[model samples]
Target: MPWGEFKDTVAERRIFQHRTLVALMLLFVMMGVLMARMYYLQVIQHDTYTTLSDKNRVQVQSVAPTRGLVYDRNNVLLAENRPVFNVTIVPERVADISQTLSELQAILNISEDDLDRFRGRLLEPRRPFQEIPLRYDLTEQEIASMAVHRHTLPGVEVNAELVRYYPYSELTSHALGYVGRINRDELQRIDPVNYAGTNYIGKSGIERFYEQALHGKVGYQHVETNARGRTLRVLERENPVPGEDIRLHLDIRLQKLAHDLLDGRRGAIVAIEPKTGGVLALASVPGFDANLFVTGIGVEAYRELNESLDKPLFNRALRGQYPPGSTIKPMLAIAALDSGSTNRERTVWDPGYFQLKPTGRRFRDWKRGGHGWVNLKDAVEQSCDIYFYDVGVRMGVDVMHDYLTRFGFGEETSLDISGALPGIVPSREWKRAHRNEPWYPGDSVNMSIGQGFNLATPLQLATGTAVLANRGVWNQPRLLSDVLGDHDFEEGLFGAARDDIILTDPDTWTFGIKAMEAVMHGTKGTARAAARKAPYRMAGKTGTAQVFSLAEGEEYDEEEVRIRLRDHALFIGFAPVEDPVIAVAVIVENGGSGSGTAAPVARAMFDAWLLGFPAPDEPVLVKSDPGAGE
Candidate 1:
């Protein structure tokens, strides 16, 4: 045997032993690394991993606030909240979203829009397992059916929600406005944290004006949930601060009366408590159902409302600007009487037409036959165009413009309601600024008659009449009688007087009232036909506002004109001339004959409101005044 061979054998054995030791060391190191990772994940980072796991199981839910209710001055509900059920979903809980949606479509006739909305919502960075709204305002049958088969559905859920409801339907549509689902624009406008759980917001009218008071604070519940993210129990809750309740100045009964008086005509009527500027009834006829807009309105329904020839969605009371027409005559006469530009005893003989002296453009009278010799009082009473034309031309546009502005024409009313239009009162400055034209005597005549660029809203007219009835105590019109909020705010913003509105000259109202009385009771009074035999004395002025430009030789033939192109019949009045209680302004669009059409409606409103005369079944024909028929 050789020694070298033995050594080689020993070397080979050593090499094999070293290789085995290295492999064992590497294996031990790998095991240690794996153990450390296991310990770290299972113990050290347990909360992070567990939260990630439970996120698949647990759910957080919101309980939306119950919207505040709206009431009329008499406590009649105008807008309210009604209970409704909705189908909801959580994306991560859904195993196969497409399959679940298909099943949901079968059970609930989900709209294509609903499915598209659901997909879009799921795409947002949201908690995957949190429930989201699928279908809103589900019927009882729908809820019951969905509940019955909900066990088979994984992520599908049913939630009880409160939806906005309008009880008056279309009666107070424009005044009360409407609420709808909050959108992206609203989201940016609204406080995200406060409106977190809110679904809808007020869009217009009083609703929008008082949105902050109506939209209650958000609430939260510390809810315990099951493995499927279903609510198991509620641990704690912070109750929501419900929104303030609002009591409007509207009288629902009177509102109904005024609405019915319109008889589905395209018109607007506003009645106010003369002393307080509290609107008893403000109605815009041919109004839409506000409830239809509470949720998301259908495109077709929206289009129909927006494109209707009658303009059902138009808020005529706040936004409609019409020429004051003959209604402006009483105010014009008041201006003349107050400014000493003309005396009530002063006489102007009407030969049925007025000529602008140097320019022989005749301003024709509504009466073909002459009103004979008429005093300033008689002129207002008869709405004699020729007599006003003469006095207005004498008073000039400057003096008349200054006086009418004091009565709120061509100005935005300080009413609490939003979106009041400040009508244009054209003056030399305004005409020059807007039209780049010089003022004319004919323009003054037109303005005196409330034509030729002059415009006024029904609210403005009512407020102005109220000021007259209140003897020039101009009260800022307020719709909310009481703000049911926690904090107390002053009656008016900017320290305005709420009561005892003082007029510089109270005697002016007396003179104006006397002239308006003549309009109802004096011989040749235009509105006498409607108010002559009233149980109570009503001092009113009838107005016929031309909607189209009539040629110099053209007589207005209502039948020849389109309904939308006809004159707007206007009337403004206060009842019991000596001690007025109610003031009103009525505008019937394209309704010819203010005395026959507009005055009668105003008479009915006065009877129902101030006189407490129950609504009459038919049009009661009172005896014509000796002054009737202009």
Candidate 2:
């Protein structure tokens, strides 16, 4: 009925036109929204989206820089870079990792250790497409096999790279140290951008101390990759900066001599040039091959090194703690003379033991019957323990500590090597802190004789001997002779002595030197018999450090004790005493007597350096010259 009422032709035509216009406007609005979205994606976010798309086919890779070279004082190559082939894989690009690994094992020898290391890396947080090394130093047969299966294996590749190598690895292991795979701890400490491509880092010694100078700048390249993430070609590259070449003060020839002299013996020898404070030789017996560490050392090989009885991994030169024994006699004699406690002419009557009071504990001397009527000179020459015991009580622990500290006893020598320990210089305060007890008169006597709470590293003994050689001039020992970079010798690139060990009366130093000289040449000198064949005059002191103390009523019998429990033989000396050149310290573990076991090693070292062995080849590495290339 309503439709019939509205059936006027003109009104109906107007209503139909208005509804059609409204529908057309709604369609146009939808088209405008769709066009706006298309424009935003095509123009505003163009670069961002393009980059994401290209990432599937392109990569930005890091190029490792060539590491610097290392040379001895004579320009002999100590550390070098050699080319090695490695088998690597990109995890993301591999289709079936388990199947691929199984196939790979069938073609080559992959030990459980190798597989374990690879699996460990897979679990680590690393870049998705980074090349993970599986086996280093791949053989020719392995390379050929990899080539035959190249097409089937999409992500596997054989990469060639330079690796760190040592020529005389065993000889330089302790001094030069060695490089090892960078662990997670080291990675977190290093700059990510700088160490993007680096895999190895210095593990110890010189290598660790100078890591900054040894690791060069990183570089980058834009690469075109395929579907399997294989590098098709390098599009653009920026070259990296090479590291600095280092020339050491160490004489490899002398290092070898020291090693040979201590053949199969557990001992340490540290020799220094007194004038320049350059370390000439640092030898620790039973050293491991440094090359074994460059690439990840095998599990068995590492186990052997870690479980060795002689402790080949231990750096005896830098960290060995032992009783200085009689080596401290000359130092104590100086303390006595300078402190007004005693003089070169002072004498003490010894009946084999010492007592601070009229009736007290008897401090037994090395001689059973005691050295009777011995003076300062005779005490040092004969290493009379009783004479030192008498004076040490009078000097007190405070005086002894002060004098020894000045000689670099309680501190590190700052020898430009890592892990050097500070030998203890015991005082009342130190005793209270460490031993949790008060200082006693007997403690003073023991300190005076370089025993009891006293401990000295081989490095410390060498440093103290250098002070005597320099005649009170405290030249800090250093291993870096020259940094083959912008450095000036006159400017003192290495370093100067911290300061001279100034004393009130400098003549006391001469008195000390004279006493040391008697120990090598005097008739009753402890080491005279050992030094009889020397062509040159040497000043030295012999000491036997007790590994285990004897009770007041007990006596030490060597045959009854274990070999490791015997005394540690020690000797400190300098050649050409009048004008000293080389100062050395030797320590033989479990050696019965210093004069017999340790002095011979020192004599042999002096003979090698002074009496002359074959010289290093021509063109000895001279500092301040920059043209020398690897």
Per-residue accuracy of model 1 over 18-78 as CA lDDT, tens digit each? 9999999999999999999999999999999988775554534455677778999889899
* Pairs with backbone N, CA or C atoms under 3 Å apart (clashes), candidate 2: 326-543, 352-370
Report lDDT (CA) for all predictions. 0.79, 0.84
Best by lDDT: 2
TM-score of candidate 1 against the unseen true structure: 0.85
Q: Which ranges in model 1 have alpha carbons more than 4 Å from their true place?
A: 1-60, 90-99, 112-132, 485-505, 549-561, 613-630
What value does the lDDT take at residue 74 in candidate 2? 96
Q: Using TM-score, give the best candidate's number.
A: 2
**Cα deviation in Å at residue 587, candidate 2?**
0.5
- Model 1 has an lDDT value of 0.79
